[model samples]
Target: MANRGRLFWKILLGFWLIFLLTTQLLWAVFTLYNPRHEAPEDNIARRIGNVQIGTAGAVLARGGLQALEELKASWPPDERKFFSDSPVVDAPPQGEGALPSMQQTRGAVSRLVMAPDGQRYLLRYDLDGLRNEYHQGRRSSILHMPPPLFWLGLTGGLLFSLLLAWNLTRPMLQLRRAFERVSRGDLSVRLFPVMRRRHDEITDVAKDFDSMAERLQVLVSDREALLHDVSHELRSPLARLQLAIGLAHQNPKNVYASLDRIEHEAGRLDRMIGELLALSRAEHQGALGEDYFDLLGLVEAVVNDARYEAQVPGVDIQLTAHQPEDYTVKGNAEMMRRGVENIVRNALRFSAHGQSVFVSLSRVDSLLEITVADQGPGVEESKLSSIFDPFVRVNGPLNGKGYGLGLAITRKVVLAHGGQVEAFNGPGGGLAIRLRLPHWE
Candidate 1:
């Protein structure tokens, strides 16, 4: 919560500071570009001062110095201070010099004017005094901005920044809370519904969070179910072992038979424990070290082993390859071999005498495809999906022959290697299992 508050304040202050800086920058630019700050002689006040001096010079040229003096005396005090003249000893030069022209001197302007009788007068006007009087009459500065407008803009910026910060932090706070709940084992929590209306990156993050929570929930549920199944499976073998010992104690004559039964149960327990370990290892992707090997070789090895087992049941195991290319795959070689062997052995187990179990390897696009099909009764359509689940066995003549962990282990291995496995009934009659693994370049 404190972090959220800090983030909110940071965003708010950042935007507000940017707004303030922008406004001040505009003010500075306006001050630098203002026309009043240009050359003094070209300013409006200087232009007005020149016009007054010209009027005085025009009067001196046409009506002589006495007439200009009379005109100045009749004017107001503020206007009279701007006009003054002195007589020149020599007559003004001809042409450009004879014309009335002004020169600037210490906050004032002086012009040489010629009377009709060749008498020259130097007329002067106070530019500083004119500019001062103009400013005093206006009673305002150009740089002075209205306080109400400044305060209104500042307040508007504050509100806008506050709104923007709140909108960003509100969703973050919600996601933080959702993460906290998930950490506390609350996987049922969902974020997409509440944030879906936003339709932004935040919504996409919420969607990913929801998916993570759902996957964790499924993993936890499956772990619990597997634990229960393991306990039940172990209990049966343990009970049988205890019963065999009790029988041996009661009947000494059949002690050898009881010992044989105990040995068989112990072997079965060992096999179950080994397969359980293999299944657990298969589920962990990290433990499956990356090692590239020929997938076709692995399939051939599994088929060769299954053929020996098939001889007793009078079942034929055939291996075929279609358009074989580089069937290299990257994963733990032992795990891959075990996964393929389980699928083939399962096919051979269900096949009757004089039946054939077909095993094929081929390359499809960027994937290596291996399929095992058996000429035996296939699994029910409803139970096809569950056949790869741990301890889930379809009811058949060989249902109790072995613990149902082979297909489950095979699925975990395939998934860990970024592959897929699926079981479906064959078109003719039997079960067909397919495995597809990414082909390494």
Candidate 2:
């Protein structure tokens, strides 16, 4: 039930969190890429220390301390800063041996070798300075190593997230407005063409919304027309009954005639009420069950009953089904019978004298196709699609035979059983109604 804006924020935040976690994971992986974490001995520093002292000691060995001083004076200014101490020359003290003991000055300079004579030489090297230079170099390399790539990734991720969030939220916002319009009785609202460029679940939802709106518009129109027709139908019979009652009151001697007329009108009213109830039930019926029965038998029964009741001059009702056995289908047998009976009776009512109403049944693939064709004048081409709507009666010679709920009820029943009904003008003449129902395999 959350709104699209809220959902968009939620999705964007989730994606951002994922991106942050991915960045952290990459940093961790890169930082720990060096498997050897144990600190190795400072071999480079030691090598620098050894070379400095060895070169100084070689100078002192080859020349005397004064010659070494001259050699140091001739060195570069950068190299002169290391020897910030005075040299010492001494022999082994009274009880000590001539062997040299390791000694360092300022934690950097150390004694490399003792002079061959009783005299000793000193060396100066700054180990701490060497370490500072090494660490600074490392820190500089780490901070400056291609930072642009990370910035580019961050910018790209932010833009992509914003774009994706907008794509998802914009459609939902449009759909929310569409729902609001539909709720306000705007059945003409549509989201198809607006979202047609998008190919996703949002587009699918838009398509469904368009279809639902279309169906709702049609149903609303049909219901309004049905209400108008029902009022007209009931008014006629009630007006006749009122007139009959008034006449009876005026002339008591002629009450029998008025009573007969009243009875006829009452019967017609009752039939109309019954048909309306039947139409309502057919429209709102639940799922059909597996009450498999002979469809052909049902059709035959309808045809026989219609033939006996046929009042049209010289009109005949005939069945044209020729099969080894009856066609069986799964559904409420009574409902199917009523549906077929309505089409046949409607056909019988319209046919002219000497005309035959043909009822044919056959299996077409997985369906039982039943068709009823009459020789009566077909309906208007423009009205053909709505002929099965409630209270929709074609303007023809036999229009007064019954209220227009028969074919409507027939359509409802057929649709309830997962079937369809269609009416079209027959090629030769008159109208043909076809009912296609799923047959039991």
Candidate 3:
């Protein structure tokens, strides 16, 4: 779980950094390309070059350097042009490499001077430096930007990306801790609701995690109850067996009765274990064995099988349906049958002898409704909710003289088929168990 958050942040930061760096570099490149807008083969620069050539000619005339060169006096044409009329000042370095008039315009000429080699120079008289004055009017060159601006942008983008990563990962970290605790046997922990988004994917994930954790806690609690009930159930049979052994060694006449009690208790234990096993199988298989069955026929079969052991002397169970033999529903056959039998058995046990028990099979809308009603005393209103809990015997000893796992197992079976079971006092008198199942072909 921790790994999930880490992976999310890594991918988030990786993509964001990639996009940030690439976009920043692209912007720099476009800016660099925008300023190289020099016109090709310009005429202004050519006129500037001719002006320098003419200036070079005047410099040659002032000293008659051409005549000295023609006489072969071992003097350079530029050396003869040195003026003796006034003491010469030192020139800026590389006056010989100055630009021609074609490269220097009217505004550029003021900063330029012609040398004897037909070259123009941008001579800054006040500055007396070799560097050109780049800050002239209407022809400003690109200025170098300060280096800190790029650093500022990079730092800001990184901070924003990290903030986004945190927002995406914080709730995941909290959820991981909750899941870890639950996995390690702490079923009470809950994930902190750090993500408050109503419709986003993260919010959906959070809600699902909360729901799963809640369900897990309920299951864990139910398992604890099952373990407790099983242990208590085992003790009774073991105690009976111990008493029977003690009696057999002492009193032969009472041995049979003691042994019979032991056998009966052992049988109860076997049946309880079997019911629990069946419930477990039903839960594990889920809907694997689901198929359509006639609801009325299924109920009738369950009624006959459950009452095979004994029947109440004065109760009449009638099956009434709007339509006969066609109220089919989708469910596991054995589990559904047992579930119906449990409800019928419960009604038979609770209702008074010689009283009527009504078994109704019908469909309401899209549901198959099977109700077991009896004319017996009912339980407290609050006990209705917990009546289906395992080992919950509201009527003391039932007809089978066994623990009350039937209703619990019955509830489990009903739930596996996407159905619901409910208990309430009948409208007239006594209690009713209603089973509602989804109907399908």
- Candidate number of the best TM-score: 1
lDDT of 3 by residue, 1-441 (tens): 355556677856785687567756765676679755433223334343344434543443333445323432554544233211121246444345344332333333223344454433332211111112222332333233234444554677677767777766767677777788988988766543656553588788777777888898898888898899889988877888888889888988988898798788788778878988877776765454757778777887876665563363556666677875357777688788888888887777776667777888888888888888888887778899898888888867755575777888888888888889999997787889899988885
* CA-lDDT, candidates in order: 0.86, 0.77, 0.66
TM-score of each candidate structure, all chains considered together: 0.76, 0.75, 0.73
Model 3 off-target regions past 4 Å?
1-9, 32-101, 104-149, 197-199, 285-288, 304-312, 324-326, 398-400
User: Number of clashes in every candidate structure?
Assistant: 0, 0, 7
User: Model 2 misses residue 273 by how many Å?
Assistant: 2.7
Encode model 2's per-residue lDDT on 86-109: one tens digit a residue. Answer: 446563442222334436543485
Q: What TM value does model 1 have?
A: 0.76
Model 1 CA deviation exceeding 4 Å by range:
1-4, 38-149, 248-256, 396-399
How does candidate 2 score on lDDT?
0.77
Candidate 1's residue-wise lDDT over 334-361, tens digit each? 9999999999989888889999999999
- Return the top candidate by lDDT: 1
- Inter-residue clash pairs, candidate 1: none
